[model samples]
Target: MTRRWTDAALTAVAPTTWGTTYLVTAELLPADRPLWSGAIRALPAGLLLLALTRRRPHGVWWGRAALLGALNIGAFFPLLFVAAYRLPGGTAAVLGAAQPLLVAVLTVALLRDRPGRPALLAALAAPAGVALVVLRPGAGLDPLGVAAGLAGTAAMAAGLVLTRRWGRPPGVGTLAATSWQLVAGGLLIVPVAAAVEGAPPAPDGPALLGYAWLGLAGTALAYALWFRGAARLPVTRVSVLGALSPLTAATLGWLVLGQALSPTQLTGFAVAVAAMVFGQLPDRAARGRRADQPARGQRVGRPAPGRQVEQQAHGRHVGQPARRRLVGQPARGRLVGQPVRRRLVGQPARSRRQASAGASAATPSGSAPGGSSAAAASGSVNRCAADGAAA
Candidate 1:
């Protein structure tokens, strides 16, 4: 499939799966076992995917993959769970909405992408929408949970940038990367889960279903889709769409858990979706251009006319310095245009000797006869001497 279609599909799918996170958390999972449940969601499914794909990531990809695993899964998963556990659900959800703003800042600092005025404005709207939909009075807004949620969002943003910057190397499919991350994250969290909630009681039937969905669909499939979407779309816009996840979570809370979505919250969701659509549009000028534009064509990608001329002038300046350096030293190339006067122009023999002595004093290097002899006679021997010194 074309990258555009695939990216759109993946973006649509990823956030939808993510919307299920709250449902799985509040409805199905055992209370006070968020850490263990999160670990299970990551590790087994990751290993299973790895086994199915049977592909190994190579080179810097190994380290990059592991780092991504740590950021997107290992660190993020537990932190998210903690935010949900420690804070009011609405509070955690609102803070999570700040991802697009984080992505824009990171893209500028890390990716060197200039997210121009429109993208910046659009990115701003997404987080505002998130705040509108999720923040509420009396929500457990602790310092740690808020920090964890924001940091988790930042980690996910960084992971997206890293993934996009280092695209999947040849022969490494999406599933392999997803699987390895899951397994890596799972392993990293195992000890923490074991230590904190050793041998936790088994979840009931609905909880098991929720766990399975969170594990198989939310972590594995959602991440696979997220990475795939991120590879093709701008990272900032992808994070903007991520605003939908929390809003969807709230809507599901209303429908499935008898929670309420106010008119203001619904408006926030619409604004965020609008911002995402606006931010993701490609630059028209950047497209429809060839990488290597041919000469004598109106090549859109070619250097500007003024720049081309300036570059040529600069090239001549460089070449002129080299020719001057060769003048008082040695000439490897043919010196075909020397006039008789050039050899002894405007100076008596004694004065030339004094000049040569002065140059030799300034240079203090071995004198050679051939290429640079003319420069010495022209009373500009220092030009060649300077070039020699520079060399």
Candidate 2:
């Protein structure tokens, strides 16, 4: 497939799979041992992909891959499950809504790109939507649960940014980068999950199915697609599309788990989505700008006059004078008719004096006998010519 379609498919697949997490968590999975489930979901599956691919990372890629793994998967996935287990499903999803806005803000710092005018407003505005969705009087949602959700969202957002900034090392594909994170996260969580939750009573058929799907499809396939997109597109744009994750989860909650969406919740979803769209638009505009930029070595092979003429042609506005002033010309071209006037005004007084002297030399000298005036005019013309030449 073309990279664009591949990238879109990958990005869409992750959120689609993730949307099922809430329903799976509530209906099929064990309640108290969330981290263990997360660990199992990540580590073994990641290693299996690595083994199947027959790939190994090299040199600094090992350390960089480890860091990438920690940021994107290891830190994010388990913390995400912990938050979901602790918080109400809808409230947790609302915290996930903050991902796009957080990514847009972080991209400005991490990638050094302006989030643009609309993005600036959306960055401030989207959090209000998240607040409306999560903060309620009788929901029984604790501050700690909300905080954990926010922390996980932030970690994921930062991970996405870093993934884009420092992509996988040469000779390694998306699977390798993803595997490192999966293994690292899974390994980190194993002892913790074991120490805290111990071994659970054997899961029933549906629960076992849930764990299998979460491990293989959710952790492995979803990340594979996510890394594909991260490798190809801006992190902010990727995060904007990821807003679908919460919506998907909400819809799945309604269909599978019987969670009803209130009008306020719907409004929050709509507003947050609009802000994400707003954040993404600037990146599309920037992509166009980069496309318009002169390609490498395009100017080098052209002749000097041709290059200058091309630059002038590129720089000039339509309906302007053909003989535009050169770069050093005073009164730079800005307003209409100004450059022509500036050119005329800037013609040195010495030029006119030289013209007058030349005129005298061209005509007969009426005032001097034996053409003394001719000699005098010749001297003046010479002097003027000399001065013009010197000046």
TM-score of each: 0.71, 0.69
Candidate 2, residues 88-206, lDDT tens digits: the string is: 77678778867877887788898997766566656655665555544455665768778888888988898888888888777778787788878876777788878888884478898
Give the per-residue lDDT digits (tens) of candidate 1, residues 253-359.
78887878888988987887787777776654444343344546665565545454312111332123434443434332313332111222334333544664555
lDDT (CA) per prediction: 0.72, 0.68
Q: What pairs collide in candidate 2? A: 69-181
* Local lDDT at 31 for model 2: 73
| Candidate 1: residue 231 Cα off by (Å) | 1.1
Q: List where candidate 1 sits over 4 angstroms from the true fold.
A: 1-6, 284-391
Worst 10 residues of 1 by lDDT: 334-343
Give the Å shift of residue 25 in candidate 1. Answer: 0.7
